[model samples]
Target: MRTALLLAAFLCGPALADRQSFPPVDEADRDPSLVEFRETLLAKIAARDVDTIVALACPDIYLSHGGDGGPEELRANLVLDPQTLSEEYREDADAMREQYWTDLENTLSQPGYFDDEGEFWMPHQWQITLPASLDAHLAYFVTGQNVSLRQQPNRDAPLITRISHEVVILRDHQSSAEYQRVLLTDGTQGYMHSDFLWPMTGHRAAFVKSDAGGWQLCTFVSGD
Candidate 1:
């Protein structure tokens, strides 16, 4: 029995260690200045005040992994002029622009934390560091408590477990499907509602304090 127990522990130890939960915490209120700045920026974004929004960004804001990230690129991305696209793709220009705006607004609205450099990063989950061996594209965070892990893709399926603020491996994600197939770190496989799963590579933004003691949008990009 002792030998059997030891073997079991050895088999499960690494998997258990890989399972970690990173709950969201909002630290924006820690700095009154940041809180006020964020509120004003959010309002401007909602109103699509292009000039004011561009003015709030750093002179060389980082908007993507590869690109000349400056106010010009930011403006182009925000405006998404249909005239610039091929005639075939022009019909969806409005949707593309709206998506970019929505992504920015939603990301900033999420709870955020202050990094070591004193920069504030949003959507709280952006701070999580996954195991290097894990495939980043396959990992997702459960954003809710007692979120059901169903035995099948449908709600009426048997309950496998309830996950809360934990990392789960996604086997597959269908954008139109309501439930996503997922695998728990313990080797249990199930389906979870799509709404509660946030991809680790999802959009995240950062705000930095300028030399004049004002906050500016510094980074707003997604992916690894």
Candidate 2:
């Protein structure tokens, strides 16, 4: 009987795990200094105040997995020089630059948390850990409450269900599409609004306080 119960638990485990939810919790208020710092930094980002933004960054701010991260790279990314782009990408230079700024603003606007090290990271969902067996690249989080999962990729389509803060698998993402196709863990496939789904590997930012008691932008990056 014990062996049979163990097998039953094993068989039921995946479904139980699939129903797990990660709700957003913002611990930013735990530190008043971080609140002030983030507010100022967000305003600077909004105004595209390069000088202020650069100054707020740590000397060795991390921007990517293999990027040579620092103030210079941050400036270049924000400035978006057309000449720096390859011939093919130059035509879309303006849009690309705008996207950088928009992404930064949106990322910073999300709720955040303070780690054990006291460093603050934004988009509270970033802290969710996926199972090792799941492919991180294909996983996404529904960052909305009572979000519609439609039968088709349109607003008028039939509603399959409503997903809250849950993990879903996305095989392909069309950047220009208003809705994204996703598969729930229970094998229910449907469409969700693109805006409600945040790629598990999406951009997130971190703020760390220096010994001098001032916060700095320590990391702003995406991907695994």
Candidate 3:
């Protein structure tokens, strides 16, 4: 008897599915290494912590994902020329199953690539160290949807900081509204929205820019 082999490929971008190969990043993805304490970053974004989110990303970070038409396609979905999504999309269990199966079928039908688990890299911690004079903390920014930044500690920049999802900075201080602020990375602080920011786990020291953009040590919020 001949048996058909089922090969699965995971696609990036917003296409949702259940057996769709790569599982969507859930609460687990935000733990320990990624960046902010999952909840606090959420609070910051709900609060609109603009300055905080931007401070956490690496400089030269550009967004990409599978399923996207391309980079520009994803950017069009994220970059807010006017507005952003207000609530998280909670897929109905049955609907998710249907989408998952459909995507899974499409993925399995394609020729599979050899993925060596050992060759794959999983980040234990994502960090962002601002220039000596910037006053702020670091975080993870998810590009595409809204700028979802998870605030955390420092890491080397000028490299692609792989995350489960693409993110951007939150520059506000309130704990409920997604604040607006400048993200200090890639040698410049770009403007980002507040909705997408989340807090990384554990507290780390940070700096704030003086009137002259000089770093002065600052205190981290309790959950920061």
Candidate 4:
């Protein structure tokens, strides 16, 4: 309760006495508590206070491909050191540290990014699914369908694989018609058909206001 008030105070700053409002929702019925919570949480995110960020989470959290289950793990994930990742994934994870946080802060600061349910549509977190010689390359998600992988640049090369889903992607440092290079999550280096992969918005973190009017993260999952 005290923490929530402190956060509200921090955001309100003496600059203005007027209560700030959220992005206007089209729906007439919106929860005031949820709106307030979302505003406070976004404020803390812009400030990059990971500790307070962790405190805003529910006891059980769901951080896809990154972390899960409780505030402690979420804190660890946020402040995770590259050395802490598995030996193979360490290098890539460390390389992405800067961009990841930058995107996160950017997303948090965007208005109307949240829904009626107060789920925040965060920026995509590009991850290294494996340890490969990707150099300083980041991963890209496959956003199209019927994507093909060929053994060589030609259309007649052996069909290595076909991607039939959205958002399932590999780390591709380079692109070409003959060989669309990719690194799988299991350290497999191969070529997929070119032009299927594209970056997409990341999953959402849903926050619910507790009985005390303090907002807390309840769930997280891949979003549209």
- Model 1 per-residue lDDT at 155: 90
In candidate 3 the C-alpha lDDT for residue 27 amounts to 27
- Model 2, residue 71: distance off in Å is 0.6
Model 3 residue 15 CA deviation in Å: 34
> To one decimal, what is the Cα RMSD in angstroms of model 4 from the true structure?
17.8
Q: Positional deviation of 15 in candidate 4, in angstroms?
A: 55
> What lDDT is obtained when candidate 1 is compared to the true structure?
0.84
Give the CA lDDT, 0 to 100, for residue 106 in model 3. Answer: 26
59-125 in candidate 4: lDDT tens per residue? 8777665545688876766677888888888878855665555645544443323444544433222
Question: Which structure is stronger by TM-score: 3 or 4?
Answer: 4
Query: Sorted on TM-score, highest at the top, how do the candidates line up?
Result: 2, 1, 4, 3
The residue-by-residue lDDT of candidate 3 on 85-188, one tens digit each, is 33344334445434433332222222211112211111112232222332224343332232322232222223222232332233454554433443432223
User: Estimated TM-score per prediction?
Assistant: 0.89, 0.90, 0.22, 0.44
Model 1 per-residue lDDT at 16: 49
- Displacement of the residue 184 alpha carbon in candidate 2, Å: 1.3
Compared with the true structure, model 3 gives a TM-score of: 0.22
Clashing pairs in 1: none
lDDT of 2 by residue, 1-224 (tens): 00000111222234433454678888888988888988999999888899999999999999989889999999999998999999999999999999999989999889988777888898887777765556678888899999999999999999999999887878888889999998777667889999998888999999999999999998999998
Best by TM-score: 2
Clashes of 1: 0
Task: Give the clash count for each candidate.
Answer: 0, 0, 59, 4
